[model samples]
Target chain A: MDELNREAESAPLIKFFTKLQPLAPAVIELCEAHTYRVKIKKNALLVCPEAVCSECLFFIIKGAVRGFILDDDKDITVWLTDENNLIGNFRNPGIPKMNYKEHMQALEDTELLVLPYDLIDQLYAKFPETNVIGRKLLAIHYHISQERSILSRIPSAEARYKQFKETHPLLHFRVPVKFLASYLGMRIETLSRLRKKSKQENNLIG
Target chain B: MDELNREAESAPLIKFFTKLQPLAPAVIELCEAHTYRVKIKKNALLVCPEAVCSECLFFIIKGAVRGFILDDDKDITVWLTDENNLIGNFRNPGIPKMNYKEHMQALEDTELLVLPYDLIDQLYAKFPETNVIGRKLLAIHYHISQERSILSRIPSAEARYKQFKETHPLLHFRVPVKFLASYLGMRIETLSRLRKKSKQENNLIG
Candidate 1:
């Protein structure tokens, strides 16, 4: 096999593997086809809050997903996963068991490459590159978690939104204002005011 | 291979895997060997924050490990990886092109089983079952990141401390009050007061 062709074949798996480093072809191929490729309609619930998430991690192959938690009929978006990104409600808080306390929903009609925990486990046990993949994925989730923490500590809500947009421009078009507001830990009104101010400052809108 | 020996070989790897899991033997063998014995003196730094972590992950074969985030002069203990727990900042947060901002230290004279990331990656690519182990490890890290988020939102400092103890009693004894206090998002004074109040509540101080 030519070197270029070999690199090309392995590129897709490693392209997203910007962390923990690249994987060998064997680890990438360990992925089974049983991970059903499905189309989810806009606002379709992939997993409901407090529900058990059997497949908590999957790639956003062609659409966007919002992973959020519910509070008193309100949805507070925690993380948004756009195309080429990964999303899920695989983690729970104050709980001993592995369960999902948040929900995942499609922001648009989405196509995803799903990797279930069961199969991932199987692959992880057998493949070393998959282990690297695991580490890279963990790094991603960690950054997002830290972003949330930093946003909370930054004090000004406007600064929070600015930071959010700077770090996650991919989310702006996908998530609606109300959702974005809540995700930034702000009220819809505060978000609206900030948006108006930001637009005026940038000459984007008057 | 005899069933008895195989069982002995696979069990340690299995302990770290906390999801729908089973490990392939090649992975188990790789993992078992990669885990080399090491010791640290009390008050010694096991892992310096901001260095590219060459260590794959350290299993607390025995002794205690305190993983902390240094904010200015203060060290906030975010996690404690004790007996049977495998930990490293790289796996939890991902190490892509460096820029890590945390440190892990020994709270006491600690014994560790250190594995290099590259060695594990090689094993996973070669062994089918280890791929599953890789995925499971990610699951565990993902869970930790999620819990940090949830715990941060526990509304008050006192509640966070309560939850921390409930979840990580093993770590509480070895870790100092101040570090644990910072991790709970509280001031040292508040933690001291809480401990005093708790001691008085049961009349144990007398």
Candidate 2:
């Protein structure tokens, strides 16, 4: 990549880091040096279910990605993310006796900044400020994972759809209905019916 | 508590910490100073549904705890943990504008070492080795949360129950059928029937 284009590519991540905390320029420079940008085509597998767990952290600069698993030979969406968010294996690669069986795929042509786990460890050691951002990022994903867990346990299909809409205002529309249904632990037909019923209610209100 | 009794109580946590990574004596002493043990009676609420998000992590030394939420006026179990594990708000307390709504209750008389968030931050600042342990713990919980999310999205009730049993062999026998059913996202009757069927199959195989 050209120097100017590389600088432009790193802008979003720089903005994200500063939004988390104001850091010294040196720390940002270090991060910039350690990270690289990549673009993934739609439906491209970033992490395959059969492959070893992903070892790098991904910061989505543009487009979207999702994590899903195969259950009884059917695809079940468990995670969805878009621009300005982080994605990758939830498992710590250093931890032994753990299995990571999820697949990560691009929903759209996606741009991402990749930071390897080794660089992350270095950042933690070299810069105290890195820890805050690390903790915050982990917390954000941890919260999302917990909410998804809670959402899946909800009994009513309509209620689950409503809560999902409320929580993921943009995601409900971005992904396919089949994926949305699988994520909500319901069939596509059920999601379609609920959407139709909801639209009718909105029309009446209007 | 007497000094000897305190030492005995701290032994389990010390062992857990060392199992993650060897730390300096001073670091262990710092952690010991910041933590205190508590015992919760069975059925008592450790973190109530109506209360604010729990601010302290409970490192369970004995017995069991379950995290649940009220959905459509019904208690739906989302998290269940036992001895030698940590439980608390999955959301970072420092993260603004996030709501935690789960209820944490002791399923049996539970012994725990409570580590408040402030002290956790202090430890992070004081001991470099603390970061490894912290990351490992978060990774463990994040993996669990992801698995739970995936479990809830499984279309087959029998498959969900079987996976849950395999993941938590001891827990299935320890908790009541109703809670287990809710955690597995199925009706109590459904779980009971599945259990009965599994038992018959096991007998046949035997």
Candidate 3:
């Protein structure tokens, strides 16, 4: 984490600074200088529920983050955004009642690119480069969510886990089993059994 | 439908072109003067799999369209972008496997604001307003997909329908019962029963 994200912490936009996308050099420098980098230790709260969502976007420069809701006394993991992906709440539908999302939490110690939601809105209003990246990122997120829905529809637990592993090999490696289980819409025990079955199959094949 | 959407068939952006979010006058005029109107008969296909996605976007000036894929011999409605919501596949992901979506079809005879995808991308690259709206539109779509995930997680069918009705009342009225049932992760019979129960409960309360 330290090696991958050393100067990444000093200039939060450093991860994106060297890269050429839709943003201009001056604007990129300005962002690199202005944006803040913050660290959250494992199990730390990044964004609490009903907190007005002041800064609605984040990036995992290093480590991982979890988005979950407390429904019927169960903490359900909704999304696990890491690496270059953006994490945020839905600004439309005007928020929801019974909003218990503990959005943006550190699954491991994490470095973040924190931008004010309104400023990002302004950037989208001001920059075309940002807009292309923004749309593509949203497209990526939409694809992930849709795949999860498709997985949930499939009845077999092993099949669901297999699909998830095939779709997100990085997630299975980086994230904890519990988080992976929930994200796949399955119970921990079911995931455990599936993993064991999969291991045996691999061993036999080998 | 005709009375409710007088401009639907003729104006491509009538549904979501807000004065509050206006484009440059020159751009707006360019759009209005050159933009062709599309009136698709019921079940008309807008874009199909294996076809290059050249259509920039269609604003439902009137009527409805569904974006879906055939998965395991079933048509899965991934999106139902209605009036005021933009629809197009500017970036279709198909590197691993080519076909992802089957086609977007007019649920009824529809009027659409037709902007070629290339023109919008070019304009979006040059203009801030186009980029802002494009990103904003993607944000909404992403949010809806997340909401759909949350709805699917509800253990009870009734609770899922309640959440759907509360969050997207528009879909209940505009979308076909079958699609609504599918989106809600329930059977058509179940949704019908839920609607009936909801109506009776409302009547009693009133």
- Considering every candidate listed, which one attains the maximal lDDT? 2
**Model 3 per-residue lDDT tens digits across residues A44-145:** 888622343355567668888888776777777776767765676646522343344555578888877666676566666566467666665666666666
Residue B24 in model 2: shift from native, Å?
Answer: 2.4
Docking class of 1: incorrect
Q: Tens digit of lDDT per residue, candidate 2, span B52-140?
A: 22476778999999999887678899988788887887546344322447789999988888777767778788785576677666776
User: Candidate 1: where are CA atoms >4 Å away?
Assistant: A1-44, A48-58, A61-63, A70-77, A89-100, A106-163, A172-206, B1-34, B48-54, B70-77, B91-99, B125-128, B190-206
TM-score, each model?
A: 0.64, 0.90, 0.79
lDDT of 1 by residue, A129-159 (tens): 5655665575567666654553443445786
Which stretches of candidate 2 lie above 4 Å from their native place? A1-3, A47-54, A93-100, B47-54, B90-100
**True C-alpha contacts between chains kept, each model in order:** 0.21, 0.48, 0.34
Q: List the residue pairs that clash in candidate 2.
A: none
Ranking by lDDT: 2, 3, 1
Model no. 2, DockQ = 0.48
C-alpha RMSD values across all candidates: 7.9, 3.5, 5.1
Better candidate by lDDT, 2 or 3:
2
For candidate 3, what is the DockQ-based docking class? acceptable
Q: Which candidate is the best by DockQ?
A: 2
